[model samples]
Structure formats: C-alpha cells, structure tokens
Target: MKVLVTGGSGFIASWIRKELAARGHSVLVMDHQDRRQNLAPDEEFFLGDVRDATAVTEAAAHVDGIIHLAAVLGTQETISNPRPSAETNILGSLNVFEAAAQYGLPVVYAGVGNHAFRLVGTGCYTITKSAAEDLARMYNLYRDGGRITIVRPVNAYGPGQSIAKPYGTSKVRKILPALTCRALIGSPIEVYGDGTQISDCVYVEDVARAFVTALEHTAVNGPTEKPVEVGPLTSVTVNDIAAMVAGHAAAVTGRPVVDLVHLPMRPGEIPNAVVSSDTSTLQQIGMTAADFVPLAEGIRRTVDYYATQWLPGWLQGMQVSA
Candidate 1:
C-alpha cells in the first residue's frame, strides 16, 4: 500500500513513518523544511508548507490513503497568533482533505480532544481544530470516492514527544514542582495553576499505529454501516501523568521531584477534559485500547527520549526568571 503521512518530521509522525515503513508499505512524508533535520532514511521526505495547495496536492498524488497530522498545535501559540494558526491548521488542513477528495482516497483526520468541549482560554486553537474536524466530516458526507474518520487523541506522550517544546503540554500545575524535584532542569518548570486538573494521554507510537490501522481496515468508511472508530485509546489524569514523568525523570537522571507550588491557573481552561469513543464501533475493526502501552512505560520512554534528543536544546532555550 502507498501512504502519505503529513507532518512526518514531527515527533509523533516520525514514528508513524517508521511504523508504516515497517509494515511493508511505501511511505512518503510531507513536513516543513525547518523540521527536516530528524528525517529518517526510509521515508521519501517532501519539504513544503501545507498551506500551499500545489505542494500538498503533489504529495497527495502518490499515495493511496492519507493520515493528516500537520497542524499548528498549541493553545498558547495558537491563541497568541490566531490568524496564522487558523490559516495553517484550519485552512491548510482543508487543502489536504481537498486533495484527498480530488484523488479519491480515504483520510484519517487528527482532531483534538479539547475541542470536544467548550474551554474558555484556548478558544482560538480549539475552534480552529474543531472546524477542521468538521471539514473532514463534511467532505466525507458529501464528497465522492473517499472516507473520513476523525481521531481525537487526548494528551499523547511517547518516545518522539518533548516536554520542553512550547506548543503542547499537560496543563497540570504540579509538573514543574515534580520536575524541580527531579532536577531535570536548572530552573523550575513552569506551572500555570493549582495542578489538580485532570486530562488523558495516549502513546504516540500507539496513535501512529492506529493511523495506519485506520487505513488498513475497510470499516473506517462505509454506506452499509456507520464509520468504524479505530482504537488503542486511553485516558489518564494530568497530575498522575506529572507524577509519572517526575518519577521517571528521577530514576533516569537521579533527582527527586519537589512539591508543586501554587500558581494562578490559566484563564478559560477546562478543569477536566475527556473524550468518548464508540468502543463497539472500534471493536468492529478489531481495535482496542488494551493494545496501548501503559502510562508508566510510555512516560519512561518519553523522558528518556527527551533527555537524549530534545532536552539539550530545550534547556538551552530557557532563561532564569528574574
């Protein structure tokens, strides 16, 4: 099978590229040039912004299916610059789906969990992603010759993720305190609030695998029955995730996590955001969350990956707070 994985240079999509390649499929990766340094040898890497219809259309030409993962994904970043975020995330995604619609291919759209509910603070990012997800559904409903499945992953962490990158992070307040105890950094990790908010996380590799699986299964699209929702999904708390990261950092780096200090929570934030999956829908395709890697193992792998690959640059970018 021929497959196109958008944002293939990203931590998560990079793993998706590997998974697709390992499964004996021809893989093409479309990512921004700035992120190409980590491009693996097996992928036919294409460097171009998704905002360009010609570029995405050209990339889409070679693949039988699409896994759309490219987006400007972060609340602070998107909120700070909503226009560009909307252009890249919402408009750019439409281009991808448009090409797929033109080419008659099935598409798996990456949707955000936060958009499942109304959150006040991160409205900019949530609204944009939610709109993009709708675009996929609308295309699937009316367009000819393709299927669309919206996969909303909560807080996914794994080998390719970086805690240091500013785009996305669990909104738990105690993470910094836990990081301070681990001495993972020279300064305290930033905390936004009281650290008790709950969230869920999935493993990136698992998510990537699901992306491929969604394509392989025919039930993901149909007129005979409802769409099949692929699985390997799990929901976990932000505080629990922070503690796990802290403990993992301690064991790997030999430091203890300190207690998180109280801080003002971000405005318009959801105290708890969880997603509902149609388990029966997923099981029809022989997918389940049981295949997911447990949080402890996933965290250990994530901490180790960040420590080796992303932490040096992350730590270097930090300045001591005056």
Candidate 2:
C-alpha cells in the first residue's frame, strides 16, 4: 500500500513511516517541516502544509491512503491563541477528509487521547480534534470507496525529542521531553498543582503499530468502524513521571538529575485529570496493554536519548560549573 503520512516528520509519524516501510508500504510525506535525516531513502517528502487545500489535494493525488497526523498540539498554548490551531487542526483535517473522499482513500487519523477532556473544555486542541473526529464519522457514513480510522494516542514518548519543534506545536514543552531536558541540564522539573494529574504514556513504537493495524485492516471498498484508542491500562501521575526521569538519569549518568518544584496549573489546562482510554478497538485487533512498553522502561530509553543527544553540551557546562 502506498500511504501519505501528514506531519510525517514529527516524532510519532517518524515511527509510523518506519512501520509502514517495514510492512512494504510506499510512503509520501506532506509537512511544513523540512526532511529529517532518519527517513527511509525511498520515502518521498513534500514540503507543504495541510492548511493549503491545493497542496493537500496535490499530495493526496498519488497516494493509496492517508495517515493524517498534522495538527497544532499544545494545551495551554492552543487555549491562549486558537486561530492558527483551529485553522490547522480543523481546517487542515477538513482538507484531508475532502481529498480522501474525492480520491476514495482510507485515512488513519491521529487524534488526541485527551479528547474526553472536551467535556471540561481543556483547550482548543480537544475542541478542534473532537470536531474533526465527528467529521470523520460523518464522512464515513457517506464517503465513497474509502474508510477513516481514528487513533487517539495519549502521551507518546521515546528517543529523539527536542525543542527544535517548538517543544517538539506537533508541541509546547511536552511533558516527557520537557522533564528530560530539565533533568539533563540539572534544571528544576516543574510540577503543576502537586503533579497529581494523571497521564497515560505509550511508547512511540506501539502507537505506530496501532496505526499500521488500522491501515492494514482498512477496507478499500468502504468505511470501517475503527476508532483505535492507544493507551496503557495503568495510569501514572505527572509527579511519578518526573521522579522516574530524575531517578533514571541519576542512575545512568551518575549526575544530579534535579529536583521537582510545585507550581500552579497553567491556564486552559485540566487539573487532577485521570485519563484512561477505551482500548476495545485496539483489543479487537489483538493489541492490548500487555504489548505496551513499560512506562519506566520507555522513560529510561527517552532519558538516554536526550542524554546522548545533549551530553556533550551538558559535560561542558558541568565542567564550567565545577
């Protein structure tokens, strides 16, 4: 299968591209970011944004299906100024849907796991994603010769996280990267409202598999009812995440990983939110929590990545401080 992965250069999409290639799928990427070094040499990349309907349609013209992952993702940031996010998340999605419907292409849409937060109005991200999700279902009802699959991922973490992505809008100080960065630099890890808010962290690799499953199972003749929710059954507090990052870094590098400090929850953010997803679809497809990488193990790998990527600068700084 030839697939078009929007936002293909981002973290999760990187894994998706790899998964697709492993399964012998040809990949075409459409994103605002430049090509990264890790992409398969055979993968074709287009420098474009989903917001432009012409560009999206052009990219969709030659692909068999679409794995839509493009969006502006930030909790507080989206809530602060929602127009760009709205335009991208909502409008961009509309473009993908329209193109897929016209070309009769299946789409494995990457939605947000926190979509349940729509009830409490966490931010524009939830609102826009929820809206797009509804559109997916609606489009499925009448879309000709195509299907749409929605995969709601919680916190996807692994190696290669950085601030170059603006906290990675595709991120703003996304929790895992933010914590790992601060820990690497011996900077204080900020905890919001005692760090009790719950989060479900899934490995990027697992998330990628879930997407491929949806794509592989998609019926070319029509719409299928697959709203895959990828998350672990267990939960972890934000504080627990911070502690693990700090503890693991200290153990691995024999360096002071830094301390956690409490702060008020930022505006437009949900507080004390314990989120667990409905993995029924993923289970139906033979994917479950058992297959998920252990959170601690995933964190260890992520910390190792950041450490390796930034160790040189960190060592130079440490020498200066000493």
Candidate 3:
C-alpha cells in the first residue's frame, strides 16, 4: 500500500507515518511545517499545505489511500479568528476529499473527538471539524470509488505532547493528568471550577493504529459503508484522571502530590462529554480497542518522555521554581 499522511510531522501524524512505514507500506509525508526530524528515510517527504487543492491533487496522484490529519488545531487559535480556521480545517478537508475523488483514492479522516459532541466552548474548531465530518459522510454517499472513514479520537495523549503548549478544548482534558503529576511532584496543580467535568483520554499510539486498521479495511467497492469507530470506548472524569496522575507521580517521586484549586471554569466549557462508540466493526475487522493503551500507564510514559526529551527546555522556558 502506498499511503499519504498529511501533517506527518505533527504529534500524532508522525507516529502514524512510522507505523505505516513499519508495516511494509510506502509512505509519503506531506506538511508545511519545517519539521524534518519526524520522518523516516523511506518516506517521500513533501513540504506542502492541504489548503492548496492543486498541490494536494498532485500528491495524491499515485497514493493508494490518504490519512487526512492536517487541520488547524487549538481551540484558542481557531475560535479567536474563524477565517484561518475555516480556511484550513474546512477548506483543507474539502481539498483532500476532492483530490481523493479526482484520483479515486480511499480516505480515512482524523476527526477530533472534542468536536464529536456539543460543547459550550471551542466553537471554532468544533464548527470546522463538524463540517469536515459531514463532508466525509457526503463523499461516502456520493463520490464514486471514494471510501471515507471517520475516527473520532477522544483526548489522545502520550510522548511528544508539550505541556507548555496552549490548552485548547481538544487539549483541556489533558489538564487533569498534567496537574495531577504536578501535585505528586509537590508542585501546585490548578483546577477550573470544581473539577467535576467528565471526559475521556486515549493514547496517541492507539489512535494512530486505528487509522491504519481503517485504511487497511477500507472497502474498495462500496464507498458508503462506514467503517466502525476504532479506539478507547471508556470514559473518565477530570477529577478521576487528576487523582490517577497524582497517584502515579507520588509512586515515582516518593511524595504526596499537592492539589491547587484555581480560577472558575472557562466560558462555554462542557460539564460532561463522553463517547459511546460501537466497536463491533473494528473488532470484526481484527482490531481491538483493548489494544488501546491504559490511561494510567500512558500518563506515566508521557511524563517520562517529557522528563527525558523535553524537560530541560520546558523548565527553562516556563521558569519552574525550586
């Protein structure tokens, strides 16, 4: 299989590229970002944006399928100025689908779980992604030879996550675990409102694997068959995840973590958001959500990754006090 992974240099897409290449498939990594260290030697790399239909079409000319992962992320980034958000996510997705249709290639869209449910905040991102998902379904129904699969990922996290980055709605769920670790390490952990909001977190590796499975199981003949949802189906609360993060940190540091309550809930925050995916399709296709990495273990691994790979620069940039 020859696969094209957009935004291949990003946190999740990078892993997807590696996974595809490891499975004996040829991969073409396309991204506008100047992040070269993420690609493998075998990947045909192209520095490009998805918003350009001509570029996308040219890139899709020879690929068997596409893993569409490029999008304007970060709720704050998107909602602040909808023009850029609309142009990148919505328009970018259309280009991918149109190019797929033109070249008769299968497509598996990487839609965000944060946008899967209605929320009070992050309107910009949710709006564009919602539009994108609708386009995916539309392509499935109308486009000939265009198989469209949608994977709604709930709070994917693991190594390569930057704690210092913006906490957009897609990233807010991460606050629980991040603050928990802070507390365990005797640092102040902030919480918005009473920290009772409910959500779910999955590992990035699991999400990346789901994309691969969907691409492999794509129906070449029937474009309307929606491949069943893949990845974790369990839900956890913000408080629950926070406590778990603190527990693991305590175990690692040999000290009790601190809980620091902070400002009120952000405007438009969802009180409770959970996902109920029918995993029968994914399982029948020989993929298991249980293969999804456990959140607790994933948190520990993520923390270790930050410490080893990014802690020095993070501490220096953030000015963590002793």
lDDT of each: 0.66, 0.82, 0.72
Least well predicted 10-residue stretch by lDDT in candidate 2: 162-171
Candidate 1, residues 9-113, lDDT tens digits: the string is: 766687778888888988777887656566566667788888999999999898888888888765655556679778988989989989988888777777776
Q: Name the runs in model 1 displaced over 4 angstroms.
A: 34-37, 119-121, 163-183, 186-191, 218-235, 272-281, 307-322
Off by over 4 Å in 3: 119-122, 165-185, 219-224, 260-262, 275-281, 312-322
Q: What is the C-alpha RMSD of each candidate to the true structure, in Å?
A: 4.4, 2.6, 3.3
lDDT (Cα, 0-100) at 212 in candidate 3: 80
Candidate 2, 1-322: lDDT as tens digits: 8899999988789899889999999999888978756567899988899999999999999999999999898778888899988999999999999998888888888888888888876889789988999989988886664478888888888886555342332347677887877777677887888788898788899999998877777744343465788988788788988999999888767877679999888876677887667766686556787778889889988888878876666677669989
Native-to-model Cα distance after best TM-score fit, residue 92 in candidate 3, in Å: 0.5
Q: After superposition, how far is residue 55 of candidate 3 from its true place, in Å?
A: 0.7
- Number of the top lDDT candidate: 2
Cα-based TM-score, every candidate: 0.82, 0.92, 0.87
Over the stretch 1-322, how does candidate 3's per-residue lDDT look in tens digits? 9999988777788778767877888988889876777557777887789999988998999788999998876555565667877888899999999999887787888876666544445567778887898898888787785678877666777776545423221342355346644654467676666666666777888877888877886744333254456546566767777777766666666676656565576644555545445555566446877777887788888766655555455456557644
Model 3, poorest ten-residue lDDT window?
Answer: 164-173
